[model samples]
Target: MSTTTHETRIDVDPDVPLVRITREFDAPPAKVFRAHTDPELVARWLGPRGLEMSIDHYDCRTGGSYRYVHRRGDEEYGFHGSFHEVRPDELIVQTFTFEGEPDGVALEKLVLEDLGDGRTRLTSTSLVDSFAARDAFVASGMEVGVREGYERLDEVLAQG
Candidate 1:
């Protein structure tokens, strides 16, 4: 058995209104892609651990749309997005919007790279409309969610 640990790296562009995230997974690209496209698998590992996620609708194909809600105690947060392009186990392009800040829509692209040995690297970039918007996103404690979510995903992938 191989014992390897992966960490998530988030980079905020100082000049451009973009944020880039990179993480490695022990599973292959296809498996990692499935975890992202499948709503059930996504809900299992998509956010911070304490929140309960409920998907209103999750259509991951090209031109498909999705809406999901995360609830923590008495607070509920909603997010919706439209998939612009989807390529199985390779790429995904989408628009993301948080209900709280409807004006701050972001265009995101995710790419999965095969690292051989049953491992994969996932890189995602989110481009917001303005630097303020990007800064706000980074300040929102998204790193916690990203790190914890990937950790959960590692467990999910290991179960197979």
Candidate 2:
């Protein structure tokens, strides 16, 4: 078994208005792609560590809608998004809105690549309307949450 801590690549534009994060998983591309579209799988591993998720609705096809709520103790965060494009095993594009800050919505593009060595690399790019908004999100400790979330995903994949 290959025991390697996957490094997350996050890029923020100092002049532009976008944030990008790339991560690699030990699982195959098919499995990784399924995790994103499958409601059961996503609800199991798609939040910050210790946050429980409740899926209100999930339709992963093109032009479909997805809504979910994440609960952390007494606080709950809701997110709703619309899928712009959904190409199986390849790419997905969507518009995301956070109920916490409705004005902080973004367009997200996620691409999955099969690395051929029993690994899959997922690259997620999020474009906000302003640089300040992008910066604020990056400063919000989302990186740590992302790391923990992926670690949870690794555990989920390992279960089977």
Candidate 3:
């Protein structure tokens, strides 16, 4: 049996160029971590609803890089990044770049903490170069995409 929850908490620090997101899943750490690192599972639940996602290449490991695109109708959004570190079922550190603003790159770190009883808590922090860049990312409707994507992930988890 599995469960579903939609309690994603997002915080943007005013004093620093950072964004933090915390969410809980009704699954173990390894399962959630695999969902994040596996390209096939990532394509199933890593973006907003109604967008077709295509992965150019996704190598999730230390020193590995990934590039993917999401398309809705004629519009296409591309993102690429490199994995700086990977700790199975525990942590991932990576660089994130949106193709639209090539210069506004962010370093992201995600940590998964097991809550016991088949649940995991995911804490994600993104640090950008400037407050303006962080604000821009916050203003880009990222919350919607994030929340919906996690909701979809919850559903996917429920299936297992």
Candidate 4:
């Protein structure tokens, strides 16, 4: 199904070690990349709509570290990770772990393609250690959160 806002098409292959999600954005690759690196912009669209994000630390360079918390009412979730690779306007690879569910941690890579004409395509692939880890991520409602987060990102991009 198509969405009025940006759409993320996720594909899960049981035999593959990764889950991939691809989406197109009206913004340029550089602008989209900056939205991911800039802590303020990142925080604004990092979690579910009802949740608020607070970045304790964020360093987007290679080998850099990041820690943030997602809060909704009285509940809070913490996530911390380190960047494995960073290629500005091209790709980003990182290890991501949620404190609430460490078993679901995975190595994630985001590849950005500049479609030109003020458009970009982002493909995110997360490689997990086991199928169970992947299953847990799906069961945790992360897909919904990710979609919502991107919708928020669309709004942020449109505002500027």
Residue pairs in collision within model 2: none
Candidate 3: tens digits of C-alpha lDDT, residues 8-121: 999998788999999999899999999999999999999899999999999999999999999999999999999999999999999999999999899999999999999999
| Predicted structure 1, TM vs. truth | 0.96
The runs of at least 3 residues in candidate 4 whose Cα sits more than 4 Å from the true structure, single-residue gaps closed, are 1-4
Q: Where does candidate 1 clash, by residue pair?
A: none
Tell me the TM-score of each prediction against the true structure. Answer: 0.96, 0.94, 0.97, 0.94
TM-score preference between candidates 1 and 2, better one:
1
Q: Supply the TM-score for candidate 4.
A: 0.94
lDDT of 1: 0.94
The regions of model 3 sitting more than 4 angstroms off are: 1-3
Clashing residue pairs in candidate 3 (N, C-alpha, C atoms within 3 angstroms): none
For candidate 2, lDDT tens digit of each residue in 10-113?
A: 99967779999899988888888888899999998886888899999999999899999999899999999999999998899999888888988899999999
- Over the full model, what C-alpha lDDT does candidate 2 score relative to the true structure? 0.88
Task: Write one digit per residue (lDDT tens) for candidate 1, span 57-142.
Answer: 99999999999999999999999999999999999999999999988899999999999999999999999999988999999999
Candidate 4 per-residue lDDT, tens place, 43-157, comes to 9888789988899999999989999999988999999999989999999999999998776678999999989888899999999988877877777888999899889888877
The parts of candidate 1 lying over 4 Å away from their true place are 1-4
Better of 1 and 3 by TM-score: 3
State the local distance difference test value for candidate 4: 0.88
